[model samples]
Target: MPRIHFIAIGGNVMHQLAITLARKGYQITGSDDEIFEPALSNLQSAGLLPKELGWYPLKITSNLDAVVVGMHAREDNPELVQAKTLNIPIYSFPEFIFNESRNKLRVVIGGSHGKTTTTAMVMHVLQQQSFQFDYLVGAQLNGFEHSVQLTDVPVIVCEGDEYPASALDKRPKFHFLFPNIAVITGIAWDHINVFPTFEIYKAQFEIFISKIEPKGTLIYNAADDVLKALVKKQPRNDIQYIPYALPQHDVKEGITFITIERITVPLKIFGNHNLYNLHAAYWVCKTLGIDARSFLTNIQSFTGASKRLEVLLQTNDVTVFRDFAHAPSKVKATIEAVKQQYPLRHLTAVFELHTYSSLSTTFFKEYKGVFNMADSCAVFYAEHALAIKKMPPINEVLLKQCIAQPGLSVFHTKADLQNWILQQPKEYTNILLMSSGNFDGLDINELKNNFIHL
Candidate 1:
């Protein structure tokens, strides 16, 4: 059995990867500076958790087979330094995934917004068809308990993130995968802390496209102008390019109907972005030799990936949804999708400024005009976020001005924001809470249980 040590194994993806590897009969041992619940509990259940909480250099032995580094670990991590001193091979999470699945047919889904949904769709279809495959998705699906699964299966579906692989690896995570079947949903500027500029952010996708295996296929979203441009610029003649767009769909009584050639299927998930995601998944399934009809049949039941506009509470008069939308394009797309799905309802969109980019004063202007679709908007920023990012205090006045909505409100305190939410009229109002963080550990479930009941 290969002995693997995971640095910062307490992270969401890292824990899942460690658990998956452990289940495969690999001897997994891991350490983190601090381990949080769910991850800690999950790792403990798998018998892979470190005996203690803190990292120790003595834990790294020369006999260890390999070390997997997570993004949560810093450059100067003690365990990481010790592993380097012992000349142990260190692999970024993505790099290790590539190494593990090199013999399998790799399907990498890359994009800023819809990669999770697209990956989930492909996995759901394959699962429904009883086709065995390994996968690494960002969000937990309804049927799947874990996000990362590695098996002796012939195919592996991976959600390709454009973020840096690790502190030591400057390459984007997707760059290491070298996919056999690649899909780019769309290109949108994100992770400003790493990419810094839109041009630099878009170039990552270009690089990802270039890394496709010879004679492999490139499935792309034709509706996105950026993706279209990138696809056009591809110099590889051996790569097969398949472009997708939104399928013909109509909204009736707050539900979306997707028409696939002769078959019209009513879907539980609605929105243009989701429709685009479905199309991207359809092309990938087709390339995998799955019939379009069978793929569509399976997709009708996919509610969505967790936290991608997940409905937290719904009553006769009000509905509340929580979404992992932090980027400007994602913020705009999510709000528009919600409004378009329920045209008659009033939207009270609450957004948390949590990401390093969103908190940075330099990148704040990119969010301008994103919240104009909402009937009312609230922007919340935690003071500690500024301190953590080492950024100057975000000017709430400037944020409000940038959002440009007449009734825009900004809050620096969670108490004030919670009280404001509680005070709002509970009828015909759809609350969309958007963030990548937990709003500084706000109890959203408690809010839903208490306020919705009242």
Candidate 2:
């Protein structure tokens, strides 16, 4: 069995990969400065957790087959430096994933938002069809055993992230995958700490398109004007390009159904954005030879990926959903989904400004008109987050003014946010909690229980 050591294993995907390899009978060892719950507990459960935290260069030996590098590790990370000194092979997470699935058909989903949902949808349909395939998805799904899987399967579906691969490799993660089949959900400027400009951010997608294998297929979202223009500008004669838009659908009361010809398919997921994701997934599956009838039939059971508009609690008159929507475009799409799903209900959208991009004052203008659908809107940002990111203190008044939501409420404390939520009227209401952070360790289940019972 191959022995692998991870430089920074506490990352969500890194830990999962370690556990997966351990389960596959590989010898796995890892180190990290700090290990958080879920990742810590999961690694411990797998018997792959390191005995201590912090880097130990002594663990890097010539006997190790390879070192898997996590993006969280710095260029000068002691173990990483040691591994290089020892002449052991080093692979970024994406690099290793591509290495493992080099012989398989790679379907890489890329975009700023909705890629996870789209990837999950594709995985769901393929699993339901009982097709043997490997996958690496961003979030935990209903039937998946782990986030990363490696087998002798002939096909692999990956949620192609555009973030930097690792500290040593500054290229975008998806660039290394070199997908045979590529899907771009949409492009919105993100990761400002790295790209720093909208043009640079968009250029990454162009590079990704150029990286597609010769004569391979490119599937994209046609409804995204920016993405559409980009695709049109680059005419790839060797590649087959396919664009998908939201399929014709209906929302009756609270359920969403898409009708095609004489067959009407009911979906467990709601929202126009989700509909668009589903359309993209359908095209991907179709390209892989799954018939349109079987694709729609199998997709009916896909609720959603975890934390992507996941409905946590529901009552006869009230429903509460939690989503990972820290970006501006995602925030707007998520709120619109709930509003469009329950058109009669009062939608209360609460967003946590948690990510580096969202917390920075420079990117606040992108969110100006994203909250018009909410009957009531609240924005929360932990004060300590600013200190952690080394950003200047945010003025709540200015933030509210910049968001341009006249009656928006802004809070810097978790307690204040909790109180506001508990005090909300419960009749005919839909509550959406959107964030990439935990809202300063807010227990979502407990909050949902309290709200639903009240």
Candidate 3:
């Protein structure tokens, strides 16, 4: 096994990759400026946590077999500089993953949203059918012990991210994976810091479609008008385009069910967006030799990918959920999903301005009426987060005006949010928390425990 050094290894998937490699008997070591919870604990549990915080150029010795750079590291990072100077084989995780699976049949799930869940859905059904495959998902999916798995396998499923691969690479991660089968959940403008304009953000997907392996199959969401137009705009006669729409599904008393082949199968997940994602998975599985009925039968057990509409607590009276939805489109979709599922309940939605895009004053306007579906909505953006990101303080009035929700409440402090959540009516209210980041260290399980007896 090679000695791999991870530069800025505290990232969600980076840490998991380090763990997987170390378990495979590779000598793995990692360093980061600061490591956060989950990643911090996970690395320590794997005995791979760096002994010190921050970059150490000295650690990038000439003997190191390779230097794996994470997106968190800057181009001029001291460790990266050292690795470059030493001529160490440098690669981003995506680049490395693609290289490792070059000989495998790759299924890359790309889009602005729903990549994680859709990839999880495909992986779940494949595993259930006893298929041997590798995968790189963005989140910690239930039943899967790790997020990145690389080995001698014929098939590799990847959650293709549009974020820049690495500071050094400067290309979207998905661009690195030339897939035999590609899925686009939908195109939504996001990562405002990188792709500043929606057109520029979307152009990456166009490139992605062009990069698909010759004669590759493209499964996309036909419901997204922008994406639909993009697919139609391109005349790639070499590839097969398979468009998927939301399947026939109905919600019955907070439970969602989908129909396939004249048989009804109940689902643990909700949302029209999720139903569309399921269809994306359904098509991919179908292309990979899994029958439609088999895909549906096994998908019944896939509760969901973690933090993407994950149910935190549920009781007779109160139901609490948290999701990794920070973008305007995602927030709108999540709010609608929860509200539609529990239409009878008084929905109290809480959102955190966690991403740089969500915190931007310009991007705030994109959130117009996003939370309008919720009975009560509150937005939380930590002043500390703004200061750390070096972003200008958000104008509270402008934010409220942008959201356009008359009943919306804005909170800068977590204590205020905690208090607000505690005060929401217990018996008839369904609390939904949406953010890619933890609400500035708010404990969801603890919050759920408070309403356990209700």
Query: How many times do residue backbones clash in model 1?
Result: 0
Ten consecutive residues with minimal summed lDDT in candidate 2? 253-262
Error of 2 at 335 (Å): 0.6
After superposition, candidate 3 runs with Cα above 4 Å error: 44-47, 51-58, 61-65, 443-446, 452-454
Model 1: per-residue Cα lDDT over 1-454, one tens digit each: 9999999999888999999998899988899988998898898888887888888998899999999999888889999999999999999999999999999999999998899999999999999999889999988799998999987889999999998898888789999999999999998888888888899999999999999999999998888998898788866899898888889999999999998767789999988999999989988888898997898899999999989989999998889999999999899999999999998898999999998888877777788889888988889999998898888988878777766678888898988888888877778989999998888888887789876678
User: How accurate locally is residue 74 in candidate 2, as Cα lDDT from 0 to 100?
Assistant: 94
**CA lDDT scores, all candidates in order:** 0.90, 0.91, 0.90
Q: Write the per-residue lDDT of candidate 3 for residues 1-454, one digit (tens) a residue.
A: 7999999899988898888888778899889999998899999999998898988999999999998999899978999999999999999999888877989999999998889999999999999999999999988887888899887779999999999888777799999999999999999899989998999998999999999999899998988999999998886999999988878888787789899767689998889889989989989999999997899899999988888887788888888888899988889999999888878899999999989999999998899989888988899989899989999998999999888898889999888899898988888778899998888999766787789854
Using lDDT as the measure, name the better of candidate 1 and candidate 2: 2
Question: Model 2 over residues 81-176: C-alpha lDDT tens digits?
Answer: 999899999999999989888899999999999999999999999999998999898888899978989888899999999988988898999999
